[model samples]
Target: MDKKDRFTEVVKTNQGLIFKVATLYTNNLQDKEDLYQEIVFQLWKSFDSFNEQSKLSTWMYRVAMNTAIYNLKSGKKQVNTIPIDLETERFAEVLDKTEEEKIKVLYEKIQMLNLLEKGIILLYLEGKNHQEIASIIGITISNVGTKISRIKDKLKSQIKTT
Candidate 1:
């Protein structure tokens, strides 16, 4: 397949990561869409650099997380006044189940975290090992463990209050 085909395939397969990460990061629909698009764009830009060194999903998650966080931190103005679209509303509904309810709550709680905490928790929830999480976030493995521990406690307390 050509680069365009490969890029399309990757984006199609990994769209969930973009959606989930965007949902966790932003409350507004426009912001979520913007973040998702930015991530896809970044992934395409970095597609040529992807050697078979690691799993594609893992690399995609790292790129998506980094792009979304960087865009959020950049303080660029986004038009977020409109209500969320039907798809995001449906997504919120689907994610709000009893088992997933806690995860949804945790995602809400994640908004209170600094970017580092958010990145760590996102990777951990995505089932990335500590070493992989550390690699993605450019932190030591021990730091990833420590941060995840604290994040869990913080989420527990935060959830209890709501």
Candidate 2:
């Protein structure tokens, strides 16, 4: 494939990485779009450095997640300050949550988690193995398991309280 074809394939295969990271990082639609764009930019910028040592999905996850966490840590975005209109708020509140709502709440709860925890949880939720997750995040495999356990428990508690 040409460079453009390869780029398109990468984006198509990994849009979920961008969307999920954006959702966990920001609550508002506009900020989600901004985060998504920032992640896309970062991924494209780093594309040349992806030396095929890891799976494309794993690399995309790493780039998107690191971008979100870095933006959060740099105080470049405040998820809570994003305004929601009354109509939208009511719609969001009243919408009958099917499986999708459950996933949304889970994602929101994951957002409340710390950056590392969020990374671990996101990988776990995506069904990545511990070793792959560790490789993506530069953590040990055992640490990935331990963190995922703790994150799961923390998310359960957060869900209970919410």
Compose the digit string of candidate 1's lDDT tens values, residues 37-142.
Answer: 7777789999999877788877888888878878877536755443434265566565646857776656667789888898887788788899889888998999
lDDT of 2 at 26: 74
Give all TM-scores, in the order shown: 0.81, 0.78
Q: Model 2: clashing residue pairs?
A: none
Candidate 2 lDDT, tens digit per residue, 101-148?
776766667668887887787788889999889898899999887888
**Whole-model Cα lDDT per candidate?**
0.79, 0.76
What lDDT is reached at residue 86 by model 1? 27
Best by lDDT: 1
TM-score of predicted structure 1: 0.81
Off by over 4 Å in 2: 73-96, 159-162
For residue 40, model 1's alpha carbon misses the true position, in angstroms, by: 0.9
Worst 10 residues of 2 by lDDT: 79-88
